[model samples]
Target: MAKITFHGAAGTVTGSKYLIEAGQAKVLVDCGLFQGMKQLRLLNWKQLPFAASSVDAVVLTHAHIDHIGFLPRFVRDGFRRKVVCTPATKELAKLLLLDSAKNQKRDAAYLNRKHLTKHSPALPLYDVKDARRALHRLKAVARGEWHELSDPIWVRFHDAGHLLGSNMIEMEIRDRDPPLRLLFSGDVGRYDAPLYFDPSPPPPCDYLICESTYGDRDHPDEDVLEILAEKVNQAYARGGVMLFAAFAVGRSQQLIYLLQVLMHEGRIPKIPIFLDSPMAVDATRIFRTFSKDHDLSEGELAPPNSVLDGPNVELVREHNRSKQLNNVKGPAVIISSSGMMTGGRILFHLKRRLPDPKNTILLGGYMAAGTRGRDLQRGRPTIRIHGWDVPVRAAIDSVSGLSGHAGRSELLRWLKDLPKPKKTFITHGEPDSAESFAAALRDQYQFETVIPQLGESFELGE
Candidate 1:
């Protein structure tokens, strides 16, 4: 019998691990970390339900830490098998994992010095060396091609359009009488999103697992360009600085494209723009290399007016240059990463800018409940950063339309393209979002959908 288990990301947006046990082989999918609240974060340090060393392989869906975060710890725990992913995903994963490890170590050291941690000595979840070890086991594969895992199992990846190399995976398990096909939608991307192509729906499968990060709500389809232009104008008019907290992968690039368009149209006043995160700068180069993944027009990529080049844009690739940004006075835009205010250079920018009413913090992605971004969004008057209480006097705004995840309508439309799935599992969101989506599927499509609990397993075919 073939059985599937939900390890993480079952009823929450962070941590995405799933286990598949078929015949004599054991395969794991997406060994990711649980992020957000303290309760959920504590789960990251807990032991896995199954022996990590016993798992023969891991199939990665993308490079996002939420989807691939726990890998180093998995490797550290004694899993010595190949971790499979797309080539671009492998590259991006290397960057993300190393960055994550660095952040953990930095946070640990800071906490220990400040005596803020409950533990006697703060410790990183994993170190840079652990991340390096994880990278050695990564095996790159191309999209749209099927590779045999064992006699009964074959896997293929379809472009998910969420990030540069994100994918929706399909696995064909042959332990049943006629074999059962399972599809795992990693993280569906928004339709008609700039730069990237829309997610391609895959062939029909017997079982389906989909994410519902934006299931409970639909984003307003306002003129994002106009809104951005107006915000820029208002900030510049007041001699205020605009700080954008963006995900290094999708959100940062989208902001760059939109800002370029607004600049071209002369909608906003000219101000110096800085791309401050070294990782984001490196990610931009990778994005340029993977132009095939984006929907950039021939004109957009041609000559002097490429999105990467603009009148007042500066790429801060050095530490000194980044620190120099703090000294610049008035009417400037700075974009940085670790979108959720979880960890990154963005925190430093926030610490420096949050106390000034002449500055604005623009959030360009979803912020989990326990994150500083969420606290700001919820109107918290004061936020603690680096163990210091920082007053949030600056204006905070969110561009809701720029999310990379698909909304409820888009997810339903994608599902309608496939034949009726025998069984469906809804995951990768808060409990409300997942349950709401599952209910909608049951009511509207009459499909057998269930929100599986963590460590719960289901036996496939009799």
Candidate 2:
């Protein structure tokens, strides 16, 4: 018999981990980090529910930070097994994990230096050395092939369309007369999103685990291009700065692509766009390298050069150069990372620009609770960050269509072809969203649905 456990992302939108044990073999799917809420972020400091050394392997579904950020910590605690993922995901994970470690180390140092930490000396969750060690364990597996693990356990990756190399994980424990199959939806990507292919139909499964980030809500019925042009033009006409908080991985690339296309079509005039966050600059190169992942055809506007050549996008890397951007008082667009405004250079930009009523803050994706992005979306008067509460005077807005994760309708469309599993566990959303979606699955589709609690476990029965 095989049992599954939800270690994280059970009742929240971040820190995704699912432990599956079949027979004598134990493996984890998506070792991720808890983000947004400080209480959740502190959970990263706690010991993992399962022994790191006991798991035979980790099958990574993709390379988004929320999906794979805890890897360095897991590896540091003696996980010696192979880290399996797609080739593109492996490459991107290296960039993301190292960047995460680097940022954490810097944060810890800043906290210790300022005497802001409770500990005598603050320490990062995992250092660059640990990230590199985790990178060393990555074993790239091609999509669509059933890779064997133990005697009766096997797994496969399907196109998820969420990010450059995202996939839907399918694991089968071939023990009983008909092997018990399990499907894990790794941030189901929307169909026809810019710079990416549509999510593929899932393979058959006896059980299903899926995300509900946008399960209870549908995206606003507005043309994203029109909205972008209006916002950009508004910022430009007012001679004000336009700041964007975007995810370094999927959301960053999507924003750049949209800007490129908008410029090409003359929908919006090209402005001086600054691509802050070194991780985003690096991720753009990877997106260009993996051209086949996107929906672009031959000679369609690609990333890197596409964004650089057309939009006059400048890469902000050096500390001094980034600092200079704070003095940028013009009709320009500044794109920064850490989408939820949790931490990163985005904080610096928000601090400098939030008080300016003329400026605009464009949020690109879903912001979890306790994040500054969510606060801005909720029209908070001020956002507290790093011991400072910055007053919000900037015009805060969000473009719904640019989100990498699928909304309610698209998620249901993805579920259309799926075989009626014996049970469906809805996770990776807030409690209300998860419970609502669970009810929807049960009422509308007649599927046996469950909203798993954090640390909840269930045995797969035949």
Clashes of each: 0, 0
Worst 10 residues of 1 by lDDT: 297-306
lDDT of each: 0.85, 0.87
Best by lDDT: 2
**Residue 433 lDDT, candidate 2, scale 0-100:** 87
lDDT of 2 by residue, 1-462 (tens): 899999988998889999999888988999999998789989999998778999898998899888899999999998999989999999899899999999999999988988888987989999999999999999999999999866578999999988888899999998787788999999998777777789999888889998999989888777777787787888787778999999888787777777777777777777888989788888878877787676753125644345345538888889889999998887888999789887899999999999999999998778899989999999999988778889999888778888888988888889987779999999999988888888888887898998888899999975
Off by over 4 Å in 2: 297-307
Looking at model 1, residue 453 earns an lDDT score of: 90
